[model samples]
Target: MAEKKYKKIVLAYSGGLDTSVLIPWLKETYGCEVIAVSGDVGQGTELDGLEEKALKTGASKLYIEDLKKEFVEEYIIPTVKAGAAYENYLLGTSFARPLIAKRIVEIAKKEGADAICHGCTGKGNDQVRFELAIKAFAPQMDVIAPWRFWELNSREKEIAYAEAHNIPLKITKETNYSKDKNLWHLSHEGLDLEDPANEAPVNKPGFLELGVSPEQAPDQPAYVTIHFEKGVPTSVNGEAMDCETVIQTLNKLGGENGCGLLDVVENRLVGMKSRGVYETPGGTILYKAHEKLEEITLDKETQHYKQQLALKFAELVYNGQWYTPLRKAMSAFVDSTQETVTGDVKLKLYKGNIIPASVTSPYSLYSSEMATFDEDDCYEQGDSAGFISLFGLPIKVRAMNDEALAEKTGTHFPSVE
Candidate 1:
C-alpha cells in the first residue's frame, strides 16, 4: 500500500464498477476519508441505492446534488442553439463530465477536502474533462487519478478487487458496457463496441435504454412542432413548458419514432479514435428544429459564420475546455446571432429520420417576392448581367492571361487530354 497523501479526498462517484472499487482502495491505500459526490443530471433510476452503496463501501458520506435544470439550461441548450455537433456526436457525455466535475469541486470546497480523486482511466477523455474543470474552479486542489498508477489495471482485475472487498456490483462480462446517461443522451461504449469492425447491436431488445432502432419503431410517422424564443426552445406542440419538461417530452416523442440514434467512430481528445453509440432522442429533435428555425431567421453571412464557429465550439467542449475564455466568447457571439432566431419549426419523425415539414418566424429573412421565379416587382431579372460580370471577374481575368500566355508560347492553354 502507498503512504498517505491526503487526509480527506472528494471522489466524483457514479456508483459504477470503477468508482465502487475506488472507495475501499482509497481508504486502504492512503487511510483517507472518502466523500463521494454524485451529480444528479437527470440520470433517472441510476441513482437508486447510491447512498447505501457508497457508505457500505467505505465512503464517509455521499452528496447527490440535483443539476438537471442547470445542465439543460446552461450546458445542453447553448450547444444545441449554437449547432455544435462534432463529427455527428451530440456531445452528451463530453459536456456532462465538466458539469459533474464542477459540482464535485463545490462539494470538495464545502467539505474542506484535501484532494479530489476520480475513477477515470488514463486512456479516456473524462480524466481530462474532470481535471480541467477542477483546475479551473480550484487550481490548488490535487487530483488523484488511480488509473494512472494502480495495480487494478483492467476491469477484470477491478471486479476481483471488489469481490475480495465483499462489495456488491451487478455487472457481468457479457453485459459490461461503459455507459453515461443524463437528460440529453445515453452513450454506450466498450465491450463489442470497442471493435469497430463489429456492427452495433442497435436492434437488440435491451441494448438501448433511451430509444429504439429504426426497425423496431412504429411504421406511422409522428410530427412535432417546436417553438423557439431567441434560439432557446420554449415549447413543444404549442404547449409551453420548462426546459427540462420540453426535453423530456421530446425524448419520449422522438424515441418512440426512432428519431435519434447514432453510431460513430470519433476522434477522442486523448489523441485516439473510439467507437460509441448514442441515443439522443430529445437532443436530436431540438437540434433539427433549431437548425430549421435558424434557416429562416438568421442572415446568410451570420448563419454561415456561426456554422464554422460551431465546429471550434464543439472541439472546445469535447476537449474539456468548457471553462475557457474562448468558449464563453463564442457563446456570447452565438447569443448575439440568436437575437432574431424566434420561430416555430415543424418536423416529421420517421424511422431514424428528422425531416423538416415547415418553418415560420416573425423575423424571417426569406423573401418570396424577391425570390419568385414569376414576375415580381421586388426584384429585376436584368440585374443579373452586371452581377454575373463582377462575380466572375477574377475567373475571366485568369482565363485572359492564360490565353495570352498560350499565344506567346505557341501552346494550347485550354487543351484537354
Candidate 2:
C-alpha cells in the first residue's frame, strides 16, 4: 500500500529521544511537514535549547509555550481542592497531561495541521489523555502516535535509529528513568522502579530532583503557615503569592524538610501494573494544609462524603478522563464544599512527616465551649439516658426476644448467662 500522507502535523515534542527521532521519522514516513510543540509546565532548565534542537532535528518549526500559571491555576488547583490522589500518589503527571495535550490541539488548529502527534507509549495513560483532549476539542484532527506504529521498540533501537538518522539526542539507551516533570511534580518510572520488590535508591545522587530523601533531610523540623481561600492555596509562610510563586516557595521549603516522596506499584489504565516514584514536595504541603483546613471548616457528613468523591476524582484523573462530565460534576461538588474551607493551617514538616500544628477557620464547626470538660450551662447532662436507650433499642429488643424464645422452648440462650 502507498504510504499515508499528511500535509502538516503538529507534534507534542519534548525535544527528548522519542520526540527528536519522531520529527524526521514523521517527515519520512508520512511525507509531511512536522511542527514540534513543547509545553513549559515548569520543567525548569530542561527546556533550554529545545527550539534549536527541534529545528536541527528536522522540525519545520517549534512552539514553546509557557503554561506554568495556567497549569497550576486551572489544573493543579482543582485537583488539589478535590484532594485527588490515586492510591497515595498525587496526580501530578496525570493532571498535567490533559493541559499539555489541550495546548497541542489548539496549536494544531492554529497551524492548520491535519494531525496531532505525541510521544506517549501505547501502554501509558498519556496516550489516552492526549488523544482524548484532541477528540474533545478538535474531533476532525487525526492523531499520530509513533510508538504505536513505529518499528523501534526499545531504547537501544531508538538510539540506533537516531544515530542512523543523525538525530541529535541527549537521551541515551542507558537513561535510568523515564521521567515526566512539570510544575506540579516529577515522576520517575522505568529502570529500577520497574521491579516492585526493588527499593528505590533514593540515596543515589541524581535519583531525586525535587526533594531529598527522608534520612538525608534535616533533623530540625520546618514550620510553615499556609493560608487558603475557598480551598485554593493563597499564601505560604504568611506571605501572599501567585500560583507559581506559591508552588515554587513550597517546593523549596517542603523539599528541604523531606516532604512529598511517594513510591507505588499502580494499576495502569491499560490493564497493567507499573511501578513509579514521584517527588511532589510542594504539592504535599499544600494538600496537607488544605486537608487540615477542611477538617475545621467542613461538617462531618460533608467531609466523609467528599472523601469518597475525592477517590472517584482521583481515578478519573488517573484514567485520563479529565474532560468527561463526571469529573466536572465531581469538581463542582468539591468546589461547593470548599466555600467554608477558607482558613490558615500551620504544619510541621519534618523528615517526610506533615503534621498539622494548628488549623483555624471562621467557619469552623468545633465548639470549645460545648466540648470542654469544665461544664457550662448550655449542656443538658440528663439528656444522655434517652439518647442511649433510643440508640440501643434494636440490641435491647433483640436480647429480650432471645430470652423469651429461650423460656418458651425451655432451652438456654447462649447469652442468657
Candidate 3:
C-alpha cells in the first residue's frame, strides 16, 4: 500500500474495542497524529481512565468532552417531543451518533486535522449517520473509515491484530453482546440476539443494564405523575429536576417498574434486518407522558398530523439526517403543536406495562358538555341528521351509482352495505 501524507486525524473514540484498536491502526496506516475525541453523553463512568488509555495506545492527545447536558437538552428532548421512535425502537443510539460526529468534526477543525475517523463498521447504520453528520458540518474533510480499508474483518481478527501490536483491549472471546449506551438508552446486539429465532435473555440476571425484566420487577404497580411544559418534561413525581437528574430518576423508577424494554428486528440503513434489545427506561416514561399530554392539548387534526410527521422524524433521526432542513422544518411544526401541550399525565407501571391512568391539561380541547349522552344546551342531538348526510355524501353517491348499474345491467353490484 502507498503511504498517505496526512498530518493529523481526529477519531470519534469511545475507548471501546473498535476505537481502542483504531488509534494504533490509523497511526500505522497513515502515519498521522491521532487525536481521540470521546463525547460524554451520559455514559456515566465509562469515560473513566479513557484519556490515559487513548494516549497509551497511540493517540497524540485525547479529548473527553462533556456532552451529556447538550445531548439531553438539544437532541433527546426534541426527539422525544417530536415522538420520534424508529419502528418502535427509541432512538437512543441513533441520535447520539450525530452529536458525537459533530463534536469530532469541531475538534478536527480546531487541531487542523486532515481527516476524521470513526469506529463504525462499514455494514452498520452508524457509518452513514456519522458520515452524513460530518458531511453536513465539514464536507471538505476526508473521512477515514478503517473498517472499510483494514483487514480486520471480525472481532476475533481485530483482537488478533491488537494483541500482535501489543495493544490492550477489554473485549474477549467470551463477550457475546455488542452494546452501546448513553443517557437515553442502552442497546444490545450480536451474540444470541443475531438469530431471529432466539428469544432475548431477558430472564437472565445481567442481560439488562438500565432496568430489570418485568418479571423481576416488583409485584405491585408503581404510579407516577409527570409534568410537561411545552412538551419538555419538567418534573417527575412532583420533583423538579434538571435534564440529567430527571432522566436518571425516571430511569430508576421506570426500570423498577419494568418499563421501556423493547425487542425489535428492524430494517437497517445497510439494507439488512438486525435484531436488538433496547433498554430505555426514562425515555419510555417521557414518550408515554408526552403522548398523553398531546392527546388532551392538541386539536384532532394537528394531533393526527403530528402523529404522521413523527414517523418521518423517526426516519430522519435514525438515518442521521439530524442537521438537514427537513428535520428542522418538522421540528418547527412539532414545536408549534407543543405550545399548548403543557399538562400532567398519570401512569401506572406494572410488569413492563405503561398504563395511562389519567391525563389533565388546562388547554384541553375536550368539553364534557359537547360529548355528553344526556340532553345538553351545548350540543343538539337533532343536528346529527344533516351532519351525517353531509359527511356521508361521497359514499351515498357511490352506492346510488352502484344500485343504478345493477338495475340497468340486470346483475347485482357491490353496494356500500
Candidate 4:
C-alpha cells in the first residue's frame, strides 16, 4: 500500500523506545512535520526531560499536558461506577487509550494536520483501541499505524534503526519489558512474562514498587473508612479531597498494606492469550468499599440485575466501545441506580486482604423494625407460610401430576411413556 500523503501529522509520543523512533520514522516516510503530544496521566518519572527529547529527535513541537485529574474524574470514575472489570481485572490500560486518543485528535485539528500517528504494535489491543477511538472522535483524520506498515518486526530491529540514526533511547535490550503505567494501575508484559510457565521474579525490587510483598506486610492491620456520594468516592477517613487526591491517597495506603497485585493469563480482544502482572492497590480497595456500600443501599432485585449488566459493561469497555450507543445506555442505567448509592464503608486491610468492617447508607432498604428477629408490632411470622405455599405452587402441582401418572401406569412418571 502506498503511504498516505500529509504536510503535517500529530503523533502520540510517550518518550519511550517505540515512540521515540516513531517521531523520525513518520517524518521520513511521509515527509511531514511531526508534532508530538504526550498526555501526563501520572506516569511519574517517565515524563522527565520528555520535551527536550522529542525536539532532539526531529519533532516540530511537543505538548505535554497534565491529564491526571481528567483521567481519574472522567474515565476511571465512570468505569468504577459501571463495575467494568474484564475477567476480574480492572480495565486500567483499556480505558486510558481513548482519553489519550481524544487529545491527539484535538491537537491534530489545531495544527491543521492531515493525519495522526501512533506507536502501538500491530498485535496488541492498544492499536485497535487507539485507532478506533481516533475514528470515533475524528472520523476525517487519517490514522498512521507505524508497526502495521513498517518492515521492521522486532524490538531489536527498532533499536538498530534508532542507533543507525543516532536516536537517543532510554530502554536497553536487557530490560525491554513493555510497561504501561497510570495512576490507576501498572502493567508489565514481555520478557519472562511472555512465557506462561516462567514464574514472576517477585523478589526483584524493580518488580514490586506499588506494594511490599504479602510476607512483608505489617502484622498489625490498618483500617480505612471511605465515604461515597452517588457511587463516587468523595472522602477518605472523613477528609474531603479531589478525585486525584483520593486515588493517590488510597494508592499509598493500599500499597503499604499490600492490597492489589494480580497475575493472570487473560484473553486479549485480538484473539490471543497473554500473561500480565498488574498492581492496582487503590483500585482494589475502592472496588470493595463501593460494592459493600451498594449492598446496604440497593434492593435485592436491582442489585442482582446490576450484577448481570456489569458483565456486559466490562465487555464493552474492554473491547474499546466506550463511545458506542450501548455503552452510553449502560452508563445511563448505572447512573440511575447510583442515585441511591450514598453510603460509608469501613474496611480492614491486612496482608493483602480487604475485609469489610461495616457499611451504612442513608438510603438503606434494611428496616430494623422489619428485619429484626426480636418480636415487635410489625411481626409477620404467619405470613411466611402462605407466601411459601404460593411461591411453590408450580413445583407442588408438577409433583402431584407425576404421582398420579406413576400410579396409573405402575412406572416412575419421569422414566416412563
- Candidates in order have lDDT scores of 0.92, 0.88, 0.89, 0.88
lDDT string for model 3 (1-417, tens) is 425668899999998878988988888787879999999998987888898888999899999889999999989999999998999998999999999999999999999999998888988999999999999999999998878777887888887887887777666766747899998899999887999899899888788988899989999999999988899888888899887787998899998888999999999988999999999998999899899888889988998898999999999999989999999999899888889998889999999999999999889998988888888898777899999999999998998998899889998887644
Q: Give the distance in Å from residue 319's predicted Cα in candidate 3 to where it truly belongs.
A: 0.6
What TM-score do all the candidates reach, one by one?
0.98, 0.95, 0.97, 0.95
User: Which whole-number lDDT from 0 to 100 does residue 152 have in model 1?
Assistant: 98
* Candidate 2 residue lDDT tens string, 111-155: 999888888898999999888888889988888887887888776
Best by lDDT: 1
lDDT of candidate 4 vs native? 0.88
TM-score of 2: 0.95
Residue 312 in model 1: lDDT = 97
Q: lDDT (0-100) at residue 38 of candidate 3?
A: 94
Report per-prediction Cα RMSD to one decimal: 1.4, 2.1, 1.4, 2.0
**Model 1 spans > 4 angstroms off:** 1-4, 414-417
Which is better, 3 or 4, measured by TM-score?
A: 3
- Superposed Cα deviation of residue 392, candidate 1 (Å): 0.9
lDDT of 1 by residue, 196-287 (tens): 99999998879999888888889999999999999988899999999899999999998898889999999988889999999999999999
The total number of steric clashes, by the backbone 3 Å criterion, in model 3 comes to 0
| Model 4 agreement with the true structure over 1-417: per-residue lDDT tens digits | 344678998999998888989888888888889999998999999899999999999999999988988899888998898777898899889888888988889888888998898998888889888888888989977888878878767899998889988988877898788889889898888889999899877557878777876677899999999999999999999999887888889999999888888888999998999899888999989999999988889899989999999999988878878878998899889999999899899999998999999999989988899888888788779999999999999888988999998899997877333
Give the least accurate 10-residue stretch of model 3, judged by summed lDDT: 168-177
